[model samples]
Target chain A: MVAHETLSRRSVGSDLRAMGAVAGKELTIARRYPSFLIAVLVWPVLLPLAYILGAKALAGPHGGSLPAFEAATGTTDYVGFIVIGTLLWGWLNMTLWDVGFFIRNEQMRGTLESNWLCPVPRGALLIGATLTKLALSLLFLVISIVEFRLLLGVNLLQGNLALTLLIIALIIPSIYGLGIAFASLVIRFKEANAMVFLVRGVFMIFAGMTFPIAVLPGWMQAVAMALPLTYAIAAMRAVVLNGAGLADIRGDLLALVAFGVALPIVGYLAFGHMARRARRHGDLGQY
Target chain B: MTATLSAPSWRSNLRAMTAIARKDFIQYLRYPMNAVFNVLQPLIWLTPVYFLGKTFASPVGNVGFAGYSGTTDYMSFILIGTVLANFITTVFWGMGYSLKTEMDAGVLESNWAAPVPRPVFLVGRTLASITITAAMSVVMLILGAWLFGFHVSGNVLAALGVAVPMLIALYGFGFAFAALVLLMRDANTMIDVSNFLVTLLSGSQFPVTVLPTLVLLVSLALPLTYGFDAVRGLLLGTNTLLPIPVEVLLLIVFMVVMVWVGLVVFRRVERRCRVLGTLNMH
Candidate 1:
């Protein structure tokens, strides 16, 4: 019994080490490439500015606090709305591209086979990548918030801060799960970039990143309802814009939790199935 | 006794340019799915912009957009801006990065050693890019008109006139941008930054009148601003910051200046790279 216990302890310790090593490796690579760092910093600022400027132009001297905007979003603080939306959307994108395209990147770098040879579980590898991306995305979000406040005069503090954080924490697991599922598809098809673009576009259109889902036609609303991000964004906006607390957003939280648990399991299964199929077909390195 | 060959005649240069364009066209055709994606990509990008416009649009009219944009048709306004923005992107990002791509593929050295002038080759690539961008623009216009009810009410031919000058100026600008990419030996970050800056300053999704005074001043200096304004004026009857004749003259001046600067910079960079022996470095 003691021997078995020790072995199990050793296995768990080694897995932890491996996961840390993978995450550290990603950070090192990012540090080596200044361009990636520049993109991470610049995109979060520039993308939101585009929309903010658009809103300002459209609002026509009233800035973004228009009655029409208030009627649709329940707040005339359009700058704040867009800033928060862009920050969260940026996180979602980073998670998707980092975790979802992880395998394809490995293949391109000619490291996929060697990575497969490692004793670490594939799930642990994914966890490592997801954690690193989450850290970077959080950093970007903070910087973006600062930029919006300083440059655009957006106020991010007027919200249920704790509840907003809670909603974001809940949403992240589902994003990881979706990333895993996308990574599986990318690995199987060798079309990671195109697939990521198509999926991101769908999310942008249906997930109500910059606007409310109610504005969409009924059929598109149905599609939005099916996406986990749709609920996350709604819950977040409710907490931030409407100052709703936990009780007000319980339904969205529960739905997100359900997605958080369910999608990862589906993703793990799908990845395992695809990996095995690729191995059988001897096509693991085809791309 | 050795016979010396004279510099290639204008006829030979023209022939070489046509040949290079044909080769690029054929190469592009080999990846048929990519061509489809190229056409579809702009539409995908326009979707979010459409929604953003819809979110603020008043139930009855354009929610004060008419005050700035002259036409209350927010959808058509954004569609026109986005289509023109895509063309600018094609010039700056697509054609501008073509040389970098050839270098990555290990063909730049051989191409440089060829008898043809480098500018001719660049012009050929630019022409091919223009053809592809024009086709994509047409498809986007049709898609917008059919699906989203985006209508062009004014003189289409006059709008084309504005677009033609804009394209010339953009091509001239792209040459200098391509030269910078060659010197840097990387295109990703440059392309991303330029794309964002151009989109922001060009009033692609909004009127320039709304920008901060400092930023508005900067926007006025860019050729894209004149081009965008002239095209919008003719197509949607939007108010222009300047008269159409003045805008066209500015575009022509920009075209000449940018082309001159682009050629000078390309030659200087090419000579420097050859001396440094970095032309073949990845």
Candidate 2:
């Protein structure tokens, strides 16, 4: 009875420690791979370069079609528009790969079963892994902002920096909430790559990453509205490009708040269900 | 008075290649969802591009795009590029990542121990990927046309004829790439980055004229750029980077040189891996 009381009281502190350890382990593994670091640096510049060039091609030599693009999107600054959209999407893609597959990777490496045997909460471990990915994503975003300025001449911080930060903070829960829920689903489905492709593909097609959502069909617009990324990208473009104030983006912010609150609760519930299911089925070790 | 189970003969090599191809094909089919996604993923990527092109279109056509590529049918221009890019991906991943997969499975050494020529084994691994890519490309193109209104006005047969040498050159490059994968033992990042970069620089998504001056020079230096240019020229009547005859000749020359160089580099690296006993280390 005394031991149980002590264990219950110390649980929160112990879970925090477990999360930190997992984060440290992931960061260490990331540092050991030079290719991973290279990819982090290269992809920010490389991925958007294609779209920027495509936009340039469409704009013609003397900027003949800039008016059409400007009409579709608010600004003729296609570089800045494309950069912001692709950067956020890249973060989502990275999270899907890292957090979504964290458990499956451990399973494949034969450490997951042993790790599950620990006294720590499994949710703590998943969040711990997510913490490292979250850190890497922050680094990716910083790199992208600098690279876009230096290489592409697109200054992401030209507008309201405080509002931009607020948008990022608001979207954090939604992105990772979706990732955590995706992690649970991936554990159940076992087709990690396909699941990642499906989820990210949905966002890529529906989130208006390279083009404005106004260009999408009416049905596609309705589908786009259902995704949190659509709001995130739209809000980001407003603050960063058009220098929209808080009053201008209240609807987006409110929608993000709703997603932020709802998604994590859903994620935790899904994760609980999956964890219980895995333990009951005796399939924690299966990949 | 003994029967040979394995022999180093031309006929035996052909059988070994066929077996390898068949095995890969079977393994691919085992993942039914993956097989389906393989065809759908490219289409998903194209949807955004299709929308992006629409954003730039006028009532007539993409008048701005026509200024660069001399084609108002932007979807057709992009579709042809996408098909060629798919083949490039097949070659890069087929040879490099196939060897990496074998290494991870702990089968590289045992597979190399067989009597078949090493080049045959490497080339054989790609046969399944090439076939799948070709079949998927056809489906992807048909879907692209239906969904995005893709159409080509120029000669399809002649365009394919131009692509033949380019595919051969890519296979040649794949041989050397497989040797590198064998040496490195971890090739996922390298293969992905190189494949994306090569395709990007080779005008797989847009004309090279849109690239920055230095980047355009790098694009010009790649033979695959000429391949994409010539095919687009033949099929879409896009303004060729060079005259059609000159681009075809360049492709033929590149094919011969890359094959010879690829074989030479592959032999030397295979010997080095054998000497160092690193064939089994991934």
Best by TM-score: 2
Model 1: residues >4 Å from true position, as ranges? A1-10, A62-65, B1-6
lDDT of each structure?
Answer: 0.81, 0.90
Per-residue accuracy of model 1 over B1-282 as CA lDDT, tens digit each: 332223677777787788888888898888777777876777876776677777778777675777787877887888888888878887787656888888899998998787778887788776676788788888888988876779988999888888887888777777788778878888878887988798779899889998889999999999989988998998888989999889989988888887788788888887888899998887
Q: State the interface C-alpha RMSD of candidate 1.
A: 2.0
| Global Cα RMSD, each model | 2.6, 2.0
Against the hidden reference, what TM-scores do the models get? 0.95, 0.96
Deviation in angstroms for A6 in model 2? 5.7
Q: What TM-score is obtained for chain B in each of the predicted models?
A: 0.94, 0.96
- Residue A243 error, candidate 1, Å: 1.9
Model 2 regions lying over 4 Å from their true place: A1-9, B1-7
Model 1 clash pairs?
Answer: none
Q: Least accurate stretch of 10 residues (summed lDDT) in model 1 chain B?
A: B1-10
Clashing pairs in 2: none
**Model 1 score (lDDT):** 0.81
